[model samples]
Target: MSRDTIRADLCIIGAGAAGLVTSAGAAMLNRKVVLFEAREMGGDCLNFGCVPSKAILSAAHAAHTVRAAAKLGVNAGEPKIDFAAVMDHVRKAIADIEPNDSQDRFEGLGVRVIREWAHFTAPDTVESDSVTVKAKRFVIASGTRARIPSIPGLDTLPYLTNETIWQLDALPRHLFILGAGPIGCELGQAFARLGSDVTLVEAGTALGAFEPDHVAVLREALAADGVRLIEGTGVERFSGEAGAITAHLAGGETINASHVLVAAGREPVTDTLGLEAAGIEADARGIVCDDRLRTANRRVYAAGDIAGKGALTHLAGWHGSVILRNLYFGVPTRQSSNPIPACVYTSPGLAQIGLTEAKAREQYGGKVSVTSWPFHDNDRAIAEGDTAGGVKLVLGKGGKLLGVHVAGARSDDIAALAAITMAKGGTVRDLTGPVLAYPTRGEAIKRAAGKHFEPVVFGPFAKAWAGLLSALH
Candidate 1:
């Protein structure tokens, strides 16, 4: 029997942020596009990852604020968390954003949407159970899933992953998390604020990617939220049934909890892609793609977590745009050419773009200049009574912006300005003298930048010049 075949200009696998953008762009350009999605429309970000996580985080933040309102002279009593209602908010967030990524929207945009898993049948073709697609170009944006570690006895005890945690009908009595990455930290704090006893165990330092000082602020915030963080150690094994589980630590101590959440990490979704059939190379990391996102099969490209470049949703979207520019507009663009910004969303959120203080010193040696402005010095933070950490600007030779790290409230919004400056290859001067509004969180960035120019602006030469002018006058 012959399979039904459809030919197109571009064929995309995955309906996540990366694939959706690529399909929309191509379809709107009057190009024939075929998109295959094995699951939901928005993939992990909308359904299981960013969207749901942030929604829960928002709820947790609200509860935390009410509890902390005594500092502002408002005695808002203890918050009573409705775990089911919180989960409802998470579901509602996904539902609201589902329409934009739905099959009807893409189909209306002239894309042939196939609701099935597709894999390479040949170098130029992909075949699913119901149909086959032949295309000029292809994209693999299937994204990723939670990586479950192989701890002894863990298999027998039921555990939760980011994908499965949302299914819980009630709050956990004691939540045991197996990782201390962003997901673990975020959820750990959220659950703790929601009155769940949360413990996070990590073999390495938690949020070690950020500066130690900034990490200290986050540690305090998480501790304040009643999250128990165990770093430099890990679970040796797990035991017990679904309702009651025990985590055996490396040093022999054990932790008993009502639930287990494995936020260890993410594994790229590349199962049964038949990459070898299409001459596309891939490994445990993800599909092997070049700086331009071109796979071993030059006709193919990758985006999102599957690209192995970055796992961020924003990075995924940027990858799609990069591919569109190269394939459609004939423009040369490299994914690495742009700067990436990352944020850990706690009370005093941590946002970083480019190198850290230690990294800058290691890379540039004697050329590194560090400038900082404490949040306590900022009028806004002082007024809010929540000055946790500050903004640190790492500068290289000629005052170039090597990095910008903000560890305070609204750090993401503040770091956004720094992200643009880094993307434009601008120096610290770009962040300086911006006429930023008085007492705003963003002013911290400007103040940090201004610190770099203080010596030059108030130098001996300037003082001499001023003296001469005064004498002449």
Candidate 2:
């Protein structure tokens, strides 16, 4: 293969969420940029992950809503899902978002696009099949792929990962999913709503990273939706033929299903990147980087899943901003210190920001106070008949908001408000000051914050003071 050497101000590997944003920003700033991607232009997010998954979830949610309307005086009968049409919807969503991340788009933005796999050849250089990039700075955004566990018969059995799950022509009669993380839970609930009998198996607790109370809410919802939740158990092995598969559990139980979807986890795509050639240090997790997203080689930075910071699309975009500011304006910002919000896009979406309750209790001991406001108490929730979950806020001394976990309708949107408040070092008072429109889910946030100050506002001393003031009046 003939290799042509090229030079640029920045060379970004992988055109996923992080790489695309970083490349565009750098190019718009008049810096010469080169972007390399071996596969799809938009990386895993647009091609196989978030875009398709969310599209499927939307369809499933529609199906579920139709069935749920009976409780609200309207009777929308059971939904008949055409699995092929649903997959088409997922594809159409990807097609709609594809142009924004295409090679032509980036090229028009003054970026030199290289469609090839890239690996480091030297401390300051990386090369692909037809081109070599020697840049002043390099950004690695290789992302990750589904981590397939070593189940005894997994290799021999026909299984689906996120990459291949969308390709199904017909819905499985019974869908068995491994892992209970965000992806597993989201897809499990989606398939169940789409009329598939879903059984989700997790080696550990379901939604283990989320607040336990919030997880309980989602667990109940998933069960109500016909998704069988199997927690605290691992798959001992697999058996059965192509049409029928059997997962033997550790506790001597077996689950038979038509299809098995593996959502266990993801592994970073760094094995073939030749990090050793460039002295870039990485572990099993991903490339090692400082809070500033810089690798051992100061000229190189890692972003997105490959950075080991967080495997979230939003976080990947944030990494792009951090890289641009540091490279162009000489500003040092730590990605870790920034308030990162995460949400599981299920019905009554689970969203969280900053420290969890357990983390807060561990860090501050008894100095922290945990306050909650149930959706049942929210007037909007009562009216909508969607009052399944609530909000939990962890507050420190002087009402400093340590964290916020919400599980209810539109919790993702509510968490965004909390993220902004936390970013600005605001407290519960700020949340309560805003007079949110009545009969809206947003009111739940304000109500939750109000609970934090209930003791002080309705205390005996305040009551006495109010009585005296009334007498004087």
Model 2 clashes, total count? 0
Q: Cα-based RMSD of the predictions, in order?
A: 1.0, 1.0
lDDT of 2 by residue, 85-148 (tens): 9999999999999999999999999999998899999999999899888999999999999999
> Candidate 1 on 239-273: residue-level lDDT in tens?
89988999999999999999999998889888868
RMSD of 2: 1.0
Whole-model lDDT per candidate: 0.92, 0.92
State the local distance difference test value for candidate 2: 0.92
